[model samples]
Target chain A: MSGYFKRKEKWHKKYLQKDATLPMEIKVEEVSPQMSVIIPQGEIDMGSSGELRDVLHKTTKNKVQTIIVSLEDAGHIDSSGIATLIEALKKVEAYSGELRVVINTKKIFNVFKIANLDMVFKIYESTQDAKNA
Target chain B: MQKTLNESVYIQLSSNPKMATFLRNNVHKSCSMVGFDEEQTDMIVLAVDEAFTNIIRHGYKMDFTQRIDIRLKIHENKYFKIILQDNAPIIDKNCIKARCLDEIRPGGLGVHFLYTIMDYVEYTTINERNALIMTKHLPKKSRTKRLSSVNQQLLQTLLDIGRYVHQILDLDTLLNVIVNEVKNLIQCESVSVLLEDRETKELFFHTVLDENKEVANKLRGLRFDSNKGFAGKAFASGEPLLVRDVEHNPEHYNKIDEDTGAKTSSLLYSPLKVQKRVIGLLGVKNKISGSFSEQDVEAVTAIASTVALSIDNAYAHETLQQTIPDLSETNRIRKEIESARLMHQATLPQALPSIPQLDISAVCQPATEVGGDYYDFIRLNENNHAFAVGDVSGHGLEAGMMVSMARSCLYTQVNFSNSISDVMTAMNRMVCGSIDKNLMMTFLFAVFNTQTKVMAFANAGHPYPCYYQAKSDTWQLIKDGEFPLGIHEEFQYSTHRIQFDKGDFVVLYSDGILEASDENKEHYGLERLLKLLGSKKWMNAQEIQLAMLRDVRNFCESLFHDDLTILVIHFL
Candidate 1:
């Protein structure tokens, strides 16, 4: 049983190392005059969460009224990534703007649910639903 | 290159960029004549070029008309010495600060390169002229046996620094002292310490000490990827790096210099390792007189090891300080739990009522300080007696409180209702009305009639009571029950009837007994329990109860994960 736990821990460390090696890409697109969409295309972990936070802060600083974060291409996000999103939400709210998230991955969505943040933030099934909101 | 042992060469040159090559060649030839190896000769030539460049660019401020006098001497057939005297304005030794190596740039490495190649460096003012003297010891035939006075001094300095570092516990003070002492000990232009963030694998400049405050501040808070720069390389490889020329070194990262406008020339970097794991990097850059030598590397590496240990101690002290309040709070909570456990123990039945031809025994052990499992016996009259065993959903103060509440309610309702089913229904209604919706409990209530030799019981989601017949060596389980109490207000339960014969016994238990798991997660299931009880049917009620508990204790091996309660009644 101890051996099993040791093997499990080793696999977990390897998985985290693999996740850290993947390059993080963020794309910003202007959907309308008031709305902009930011899509992150990799794991949003400690190594890359700073980039997302910076991009979000910049987008809100530009006075965009509505910001949508699309996690369609994001396979995994840790607590640091969640904290960055929370910071972005607070930043947009201070400017009387709004922030919405669109997530389709069940695993990522379950994280939000478990933290009870799914109730706190506006979540949508697709980009169309978020844009409509 | 064939020169006499006492030969001395004196030259005067204008402070110009073109003079550096001529000076380098002259120094190379002088060193070759002294029997220096190729590598040693190249290092000597580089140090000479760097010194001339500094005199021309920084000391003279690029004034080509200024004349600098250089003297090369072979001293006592064992030391090669160079003396450079400049007629320029007297240089303030205090004002000469080496730029941070972390601030990788193009210009500041001159003085550092000079200290790397020479054994002794000094600047002095004599007759109103600024003179810089540098010396290199000749390589002896028996190198290993010659422990020079310089090595002894270095060792004493390292010991002093180690003692000083160990005496301090504050992280900031300790780091500041380390960087300053290292710069002074190694005679380097600047010293900077970079500590690793264990989680991110990033190195951040913790302290940058230089004579120039502006240069030092510029490199403060500078961060580098652990796999990027020379310092990072040292940390990654857990080794010391001696870079004689930073400009030609491939591992040098120049981004910091570009941002801060500071320069770096030579670098001596050592990894701060604890338990063979790299935790930080310590770098000394730009020796004031000559490039860094093997002795400088050895001294700085020793200091780096001490710095690692001191940092570890400081961190441990900080964590202990932070946890002091938390530890006190934990102690207070533990005391409160202990009191609650004692109160719950007080509520247990102190002595069982003795009746003719009946044996009754019960035992309950909580998994924590306070338990949710409760057992009570109420005497209704001379011929009637009521008994109950209940398990709340959770353990702790709230569950223990619920157990007391159930005991009070059962004591009052069992006397009013003659049937076990009516008493259970009433207790369920009271619990559903008073308790939180999320909380519920499993309960069993039974009443024995002394004259009729019969037992009537009602179970609400509790484990069924087991019956043993000594005449046939048979076992029977009574499992007919309703949903657990406090879950539904209108749920109905039917009374279970069993006629007791002589030498027959009934065992009432909570789920804790059957669900006790071992380290391998295998539970003590019902089959093992039934077999144990069947074999012990011939024993008295108290003995049978002890025998079953002992079996459970042996099987689980002190790995009880829940409350275990057992009530055994024998009829004669």
Candidate 2:
């Protein structure tokens, strides 16, 4: 009778907690010598974690070893996003690659410390700087 | 309401030590009505006498012709609001910081007494009127456990967290201080830090929370090496892991929990990062009995970041002073102040909402590292827009962060589809969970629907903002709201709604506007605000903001000690 998921008496999926669309997307392109990357924004939680993982995995299809995960635009994150990064790092390391972070706003910088992932990543001051590095 | 509400009586006492008795009686009577006890009565009297003595000796220099206005009519809840409207010995609200009780002496204790005893204080000079409004209510002694305000619990938690560390600003101390604050704030059974070793490429135990035990026991010498368990993952990935049901979670490590005899059920951890580089893992394990909320994560993150930045800033300043060898203490304090300022800026206004029908501008000018005043704009929905401005009962960083807590509650409520009244109620209820019972805040919140031209608002013991008429060019004061948050939930905020035709301006301000003082010790009162609005010198929000600030600056020669917040809204 409904378009989305409907529940039976035995199985109750709290309707209020249903998954929704994400506001962040990891868009990478091997466009010419000049590069532009669109990293995730908002909370990098489990909801957007898979999409990010898949995007990062696919973005490496081209043998571009130097990639950037620009986080200056990102406001928050959970462990799932960190996991996705770890997975991406494994793939990048397989080809001797380098993943850099762009922190436009230092607000996101401390978030890395709170998550304990600051040591695991190579972060730069800005996207342009990350690209240069 | 037009001719009566703005009425205030000023009485200046020059060299009247005995007037302190009368001051005590009058204030005590007003305070008793607002619920002060005999002890509180004595404290208020002492504070007033010291103030009166200081004024008589220093301010007027025995200038009897210059009167200090003592207006005692108790409205806004039978609370005694002592308005020392004087042209002598003006008190600077900026100097109101928490002095170490160890520095307790008699000579300069007037401000300290006023701060420690009274609940609220504001100093301002409008059109040459030096006015100080000191507001306070006696703490409910009989019903300690029965009542709680969110602000009280939050401040209490901060204070508790602060208790573990001798001083909050002392970062060169050790990780023991950080762990102690975390343990106190989280009410955790135990706290341990896991830091990544650069040379060894391994994680080792750094500190522990044996706060009540002893200093030597603080670090416990515990180590959980690489890939051992949750702490290791936390160390490896540099992320906080909360094992709510630690016994059930596959990744939880119970060694530390077993060692402490702490049943590992819930946890909250934050990573210590410096410029996006994780230094280590700091966590509170086994939260008393419940699961931690997202707010817990955010709060831990905030505290951790503040610690990291302070440590880094101190380290840099120390290095600069040594290597460059020309840096001054002022430069060091300035850097400290700047980083503190950055922390405030980073926490505020991530994005100014581009609401479809709203053009909003808001600003926060703190007198110091943190101020007691705050005003925020939060959109509840498409049509229902909410904004709140408030001042905590005291001054300083503690009070400022409490204001942040109130703001966060409002934001969380706004995010969860909460209405204005619901938001206020939730905020009040939530304050009791973390703040101390001693602190309270005066707040004003409102919602407006542009299409219907209806504005709904609630005021929690805050100064009334003036609602303006573009056609008549007259200001109408909306002075009907309830007590400040953390006072009592039994007091409900009365939501008043009115439909505007169009082009009406609404001006909201802190008590600082009515109380800004000049060198002559004269204050800028509400009549002046009405005059400014009436003269048509300032038409819209921008003009009014600039003009009012200009007038206050001219009145006091523009040097402000207490914070000033002025918000204006116009309906098109």
Best by lDDT: 1
**What are the DockQ scores of the candidates, in order?**
0.01, 0.01
| lDDT at B328, model 1 | 59
Model 1: per-residue lDDT, tens digit, B431-455? 7876467678899888888888788
**Tens-digit per-residue lDDT, B1-572, candidate 2:** 11112212223232333233334434543343344565565566545654565555556664322344455434443345666656654456575454444431223434555666677866675446566667765255522332124223333333223222211222322354456446656666777665565555566555666433442253355555557677667656767666676688877776755664545567766776654456666777666656787656755655565444344433432233234322577656655554454454444443335554554544455554556777777666678776778887766566767877877778888787445677778877766555577788888888888678788888888888887876776678887787778877555556788777667888888887888887577778898888877775343354566456545644654234436777777665
Candidate 1 local lDDT, residue A122: 91
Candidate 1 ranges beyond 4 A from true positions = A1-133, B1-327
Docking class of 2: incorrect
- Per-candidate TM-scores read 0.35, 0.36
Q: Could you give candidate 2's per-residue lDDT for residues A1-133 as a string of tens digits?
A: 1111121111112111111122355556553433436477554543355677777777665546687887765654433455577667667677887777777654455444434456767888887787777
In DockQ, how does model 1 score against the reference complex?
0.01
What fraction of correct interface contacts does each candidate retain?
A: 0.00, 0.00
